[model samples]
Target: MKILIVSYYPLGFGGAEVSMKILASGLKKLGHEIIFASTGHYEGYKNYKLRNYRKIPFFFLRDNLLGNELIKIINKERIDIIHSNGYYTSLAVLKAAKKTGIKSVVHFRDYALACVKSTCLDSSNKEHERDTYRHIFVEYFPLRWIWEFYKWSYIKRSWKKIKQFDLVISNSNPVKEKLKSLGIESTYLANPVDLEERTKTSVKELRKEYKIKEFTILYAGTLEEHKGIYELLVTLKDFLIKNKVRFIIAGKGSSYFKILKYILENTIINAKMIGMKQHEEIMRLYKLSDLIVVPSIWKEPLPRTILEAMQNNKPVLATNVGGNIDLIKDEYNGYLIKNNEWEQRIKELMKNKSLREKLGRNGRKLLEEKHDLKKISKELEGMYKKILIKN
Candidate 1:
């Protein structure tokens, strides 16, 4: 199979990009040819570059090179399928795939399929009320209502394109259900982690390098309030004063400066914000940490960080929301906490090393059975072959 993977960026910019890289690499290893198409900058694959666009009216349609370039690549490469990790250039790619008579697949890793705001929370959730109106109106506007109509129409319109595709897969059940609500059926395929490369690390070396003294916890994802970084910080601020544990917050986002400001102003000694670390660094941290905390307030479709932690033989303490419920077995592989319960969970895990180790082992066992890269890649390849055979 000759698969052309499309995404927004090349590398560890976010979860979607990382998943794309892993999938492409795995498919290539399985004797399938891989090519990449991106509007944003990428450095890791044989890529076709399309100019990144601003979220303005008809920007993708006007001055767009995506469709033509995709058509050219489809013909020249004899591409069997265009597997798109949807982003700004998705509509263009789908249109080109249709025009060229090639089968296409889109893997929805988030709520972009149903939500106009893309976070899946519109008027119901107060936390994202401003996001519902402000983001679309301010970011992509001259006429707000037109943009609003276009955004919603695009969502409905994408449903038509989705039905035309040979295969539509999602990373989690929540995402699949969201699509189903729009009358578009999808297959649920879980995300894979690089299990082979998850090496055991020396905790002493990691502690010395980071200048940490006590039991360590890790928060590895975007530093945004929606991601529950602010909530994590606030929930643990009082606990920091009482405990000698070290907390390392990794990843960068719009909220990085705000988090930094808070940490500085409050003199939170036990907490350290290391910004964004590369993949290898994150895996190493995963191995070194006592527990991984995923305090996501939003309904995360699936968190790759949790999978990574599990792969590294570490327990995850995450909110009981979204696809997290599927991954964690609660007191077996990991513990699921609700609102205002993160501090309590952390304290329990911090004090009990045996329980942490036991949970860590259980998590690793689960990762092997479910999210192993080799196993997932084989399943994905089988899906591709089935689509091709049917088509």
Candidate 2:
């Protein structure tokens, strides 16, 4: 079947973009024709760039124009199904698909609707323990609430559009359950990774290239405050100063300077902040890492970093929240612990090479068995076919 894959951002470097490219390729290999379109940035399969919704002042105009653009493309390309991967694009794409009388399905990759920040964290960067509405005005007052009120209104209006799609997909069970709570039925489709794709850079070469001379623990993601980088550093600073381990942070964000200053001022944690690397470079870094720590304080729908670590046979110590629990079976494959356990888990993993290897192998097994692109592609194709037939 010919498919039009829509996304908010065009050709990009984010995990979702990279994974979508991989997924598109997998679908193409299965004899499905794929045309990729985005709002901006890079290109995709027969890539088309939709108009910038942000530039449009009025909401109805944006939706109608985007939907018209999609309708024209669908008619011209004779597309069978529309698979949208983001909120902005999905909103417009669903409207277009409904008008065109074609199959449409959307993938919800993050919890953007739940919170204004989309991290599902409060003002203090802590996860919301209670109902979001109960704490919204009480916590985020004065400034943040105005923007949040606007966002809440936006989501409330557009959310009903989701029901128009033939199917909805969530990348993790937590996200699927969240969608279910909002009265939208969704399928649990975990993100996919290519198992056979080898990185151009090797561990030995990466070590030499990056000057890795000690035991390394890698954290590859945005350097945002809510990512738990600051918390991780503070929690492990005392342990880091005493150990020979090198903590390599491979990403940049608003917290870049903040994190760097702390590393420079402390002067003894042996933690180095290497600004963002391309996806290919990150895969090589994965091979260089002895262990990866995804210490996100927010409810991550599903972090691709942990999936990458699994693909590279690296054990992980991710926070116990959201999809982290789904991928990690506690002591089986990796440890899903809190900040209090970070230092302990790091220390234990650092000391025991055999245990690390054992856990890493288990993670690799899990990745190959469940997260492989080939396997996931088949399942995706089945979903497309089912929706097409059912309609």
Candidate 3:
């Protein structure tokens, strides 16, 4: 089958891009052809080059302009399917699918399907509220309601168009449930991870080069309060002093100083904050690390970091919320932690080397059974067949 995978974000920006690269590679290996289109960093054919679309009125009509381009491409390439990775581009993609009379599949990855803003009274539970605070756009006194209406209408309109697609796949059960709650029916599909990616560098050499200590914990993401990075430090400060495990925090944000100051104040804690690294660098760090921590306070849709940990045979300890629940099986791959149970879980994995090794192996097994690209390709074909047979 020939497919044109669509996304709004450019390659190397986020997890969606990583998954797209993996998907394209897998599809190509199975004798399927792939074409790509996105917003940034040209990928040969089309680059939407949309900037300032997030402003008041353009955001509502951004997809319409793109729809014409999609129609031309769909006809030109003889594309059989257009698999759209979720974003605000759905209305245009769905319209093109209808016009071309081709099969359409949409991957629902996160909470962008709903929730117009972190400013929607539930800012506390928002996934990336720090982003909201950083770009504090006040609707202001008179026109606040008008801007709010447009945002609300935009999402509501997208919901109406989404049901027109042939199939919608949610990355986690929790996300599927959220879709169902919003009256958007979707099938649950685990996000794909590239199991074949490996570094030629030896772990011992990497340890010496990067000065990585034995029994290390790695956290890679924005250093924001919503991400729970500082909270992770405060939660485990005493434990860090007693244990020899090294905590390495990657990625930076507005809360960097707050996190840095706390670590500096508590000198005995064996923790350090290293700014963001490239994807390849992160994969190497994943190899040197013993444990991966994702202590997000929000209900994250499905964290790619956890998936990467599973890929590297490192166990994940994450909050018991959102898609994190779907990824981690208690006492299986890793512990699905709650606010109060972080210390206890870390202690268990710290003291027992055998237990950590057992859990890590189990995580790798889970990835092979569920998240392997070959398995995902088979599942995709199965779903496509069912859709074809029904149509």
lDDT of 1 at 159: 69
TM-score for each predicted model, relative to the true structure = 0.91, 0.93, 0.86
The lDDT leader among the candidates is 2
Candidate 3's C-alpha runs over 4 A off are 41-56, 118-121, 126-145, 241-243, 253-258, 261-269, 388-391
Q: What is the alpha-carbon lDDT of model 2 when measured against the actual structure?
A: 0.83
**Root-mean-square deviation of candidate 3:** 4.2
Enumerate residue pairs that collide in model 3.
none
Clashes of each: 0, 1, 0
**lDDT (Cα, tens digit) per residue for candidate 3, span 321-349:** 77788789988999988656888888788
Instruction: Identify the candidate with maximal TM-score.
Output: 2
Tens-place lDDT per residue, model 1, 1-391, is 8888878565667888888788777788899888887765555567887665555467346324567778888899999999888645566667778888887888888777556666755433333422334455645546666767666666666667678778888899878877787787888777887777845558888778766678888999988667888867887888887888888999999889998888888899788888888887888888778889988877888999998888878889988888889899989999898657888788788778899889999998998898878888999999998988874
Error of 2 at 207 (Å): 1.1
- lDDT, model 1: 0.79
Off by over 4 Å in 2: 11-13, 40-44, 55-57, 129-135, 141-146
lDDT of each: 0.79, 0.83, 0.77
Could you tell me which 10 consecutive residues in candidate 1 have the lowest summed lDDT? 123-132
